[model samples]
Target: MSRTFQRALLGLALLGAITTAAAQQYDYDRQEQWQYPAALAQSPIDIQRGVAIDGDLQEVQSIELRDTVATLRIVDNGHAVEVEAHGPDALIRGRHFELMQFHFHAASEHTIDGESFPLEGHFVFKAQDGRLAVVGVMYVEGEANALAGEVLDALGDASEGEIEREDIAIMLPRDKSYHHYLGSLTTPPLTENVEWYVLDTPVTLSADQIAGFNARYSHNNRKVQPLNDRPLVHFAAH
Candidate 1:
């Protein structure tokens, strides 16, 4: 082969190698920059087509809470539970909208001044105006949660769509001490403008209950995101 031809071929090969390296570098950058809240930035709950009346939210009244229905299912991505709960109305900050659904996250989602916990459950809600408010509860392994314990009793297999009736009402503790912040759902299409209320006092669950739940799902928690230009509000302890 001619020397000139050989040089041209070698240059082309180098260019191809550089291009491949650049593409791989780009992918890594994307992954590194990915944030959980940025993934599920919007509420997953939606009203049924039949329930729509002039596309208004005021026309609606009450929304029933359910365990068998979910519009989105996000398993432990080693980061956060990707939720796509579907329903009609929920109650948030005293406003009645719809109780889309709830999911669990191992090792908690919010941290208190850089302190984290063992688990966190997010009860997502949506208003008619397309706003969101997430209720977060941190859990520690100790005495089993009485309410969670009863519900766990019926979760024989711990699989999705498993429903068990419990007499206890799933209500947050009366203590209003909380950490409020603006963020987004910790899942895909991570949207922003979400209101987060994290209970100051952490709940307790027995080791057995933790094991039972962990058996079904392990390490389904999202990495803590940067506070980033957002302000966190700490409510005075009641």
Candidate 2:
């Protein structure tokens, strides 16, 4: 073989090896149906969830929520325990979005000042105008959470069905100070343009509650993605 041809072949081999290595780093089997690591705007970005930043956020707004008890539907999808919630719609930044669903994660997805909590809950919403927003609540090992117990018991049944909605208002922290940003769903299709609001105050869940979730779905958290020049704002609903 000519020296020039040999060099070209060596370069091609190296390129192929690099590509394979990258593909291996992305767990295709573990990704939620359609998540691609190569996609930008992917979620669970590393965040300073409770800290203040200077001029990083473009705008901040208040949240008006109508918390009421309704029927609760739970889905055992194997990846995570999902709950369907219906109540009076919430007003976010002047847009009304219905509370669609909420799901759980072991440990946590977004890092708060580079620290991960014991568990996380994502309350997802969608507006009539086709806008999406999520409110993230972190959980730490402390006292047992009343609402978490209801979720755990429902999950324990190992069946997918609906039950009377146990009012979870007691679980919501009255203080609304939170970290705000724009990001996509942590799960696949990796849809972009979702607004994220991660509350600074963490709720409590007992050892048993955490264990129950872990027993069902050991770990369903998506790895944190790059922030990549995205803005973060500390918001407290007025």
Candidate 3:
């Protein structure tokens, strides 16, 4: 080949390598190496039921869910299925945080006594000051979940649709008991200072419903991080 042609081939090869590297940067396999601040606090920590201290937060923390129909946009964002909307807000330890969006993770991120569930849903809320509070609910294999079914059907097909407020409200456990801690987001940027409430009571979803999500994004969960010296408090349900 001529000198000009040889140089062109080399340039193309370099560009391809760069693109491939950028794509794999956020891949779950490379998560351990992902960069974050020196806070030493990360998320998806295992909830050691035996070590958690009990507390009563029913009065201070509440989830205000509207009883009206709302439009939600569901997207299969290549990584996980995410539903975006507004209205519901949660009060965490007396601080107000608006529900921004929610998404799913397979095999769960947080575990209870080292046990992983079939599926986990994260309800991300944000305060006006930009602080975040996430409520996590685990799904056990049993009766099919209507909301999960609707979200799965919309994935890779429909984007926008109407859903009842009750459907969203049902995702949260009625008991209101949860394990609270300070952690970071499971996804990249892995921002810290996020308040987490992993509900003690898990909801139910059929085997098929869980499989449907797995088929799209089989494993999108980040490995559990160290609990460090952070306190893990279990808020009792009244």
Candidate 4:
């Protein structure tokens, strides 16, 4: 079979599998598909401006990262395209947290001043004490991203498995300033007590790059949850 044709078939098959699984009792739109949605402390919220900046939102001076390659496995859990990678042993807020994996949701989850982006990338982290933290980066449609391009280049076909791109490099944008808030997991279990740091600056990707991802797992983000009187802080990173 041709490469493009194989990809199309794979996408259809994956979608079919997801549908069949739901037949066993699962809601494609709800987390876990078995329990009621949480009323508070949900993630992927609409990050509004002018919110009171309470505590200090600090970051590590640097997180050890490699360039030549970003070792990540592209996984499709019938939801979103996630990347599993070797973690950079990092720390934040005086606690050491390791980068577990990162994933993308087209049409973004969180919004800024009530506006959503074309894409949202979430970096999930965990500490030894079982604490969780996430760094969210929003992406717009424009020029291609150097680091992201490397990952995209690997998607010649829609094969689902661990995808390790040897040429791709891990990078953090120069504009590290971010908004800090407390939220929960956007997916199943709806786990709360996560420290969320959303990068204030957004990255840009070419139109085709955005379309490529959309074609695969088009819109997988959860709805924007309520802030619920929680305090949000902004870090200038001076």
Best of the candidates, TM-score? 3
Worst 10 residues of 3 by lDDT: 61-70
Give the least accurate 10-residue stretch of model 2, judged by summed lDDT: 49-58
Worst 10 residues of 1 by lDDT: 44-53
What TM-score does model 2 achieve against the real structure? 0.79
Model 3 vs truth, CA RMSD: 4.0
Candidate ordering by TM-score (highest first) = 3, 2, 4, 1
Q: Across residues 12-127, which tens digit of lDDT does each residue of candidate 3 receive?
A: 99999987776675588778677887547999998999888876544565444453244577876657788886776766677777888899998899999999998899999899
Candidate order (lDDT):
3, 2, 4, 1
Query: Of 1 and 4, which scores higher on TM-score?
Result: 4
Q: Which is the leading candidate under lDDT? A: 3
lDDT of 4 by residue, 1-238 (tens): 8999999999999999988765433233554453434567778788887884744434443333333354667665566667676645555555677777778888899999999888899888888888988889888887887656655655456555544554323335566677888898877656788889888888888888888778776767788888999888776655
Write candidate 2's Cα lDDT for 1-238 as tens digits. 9999999999999999987665544443556445354566668977765445643245546666677476788887656788888874677766788988888888799888789987889888899878899989888898998878887777567767666867755455667677778888887556788999888788888999989878876667888887776778777655
Each model's lDDT comes to: 0.55, 0.77, 0.81, 0.72
User: For each candidate, C-alpha RMSD in Å?
Assistant: 12.2, 10.1, 4.0, 7.7
Worst 10 residues of 4 by lDDT: 59-68
lDDT of 1: 0.55
Question: How far does residue 201 in candidate 4 sit from its true spot (Å)?
Answer: 0.6
Score residue 101 of candidate 2 by CA lDDT. Answer: 82
Candidate 1 structure quality by residue, lDDT tens digits, 5-61:
999999999999998765543342254554343433332221122322221233332
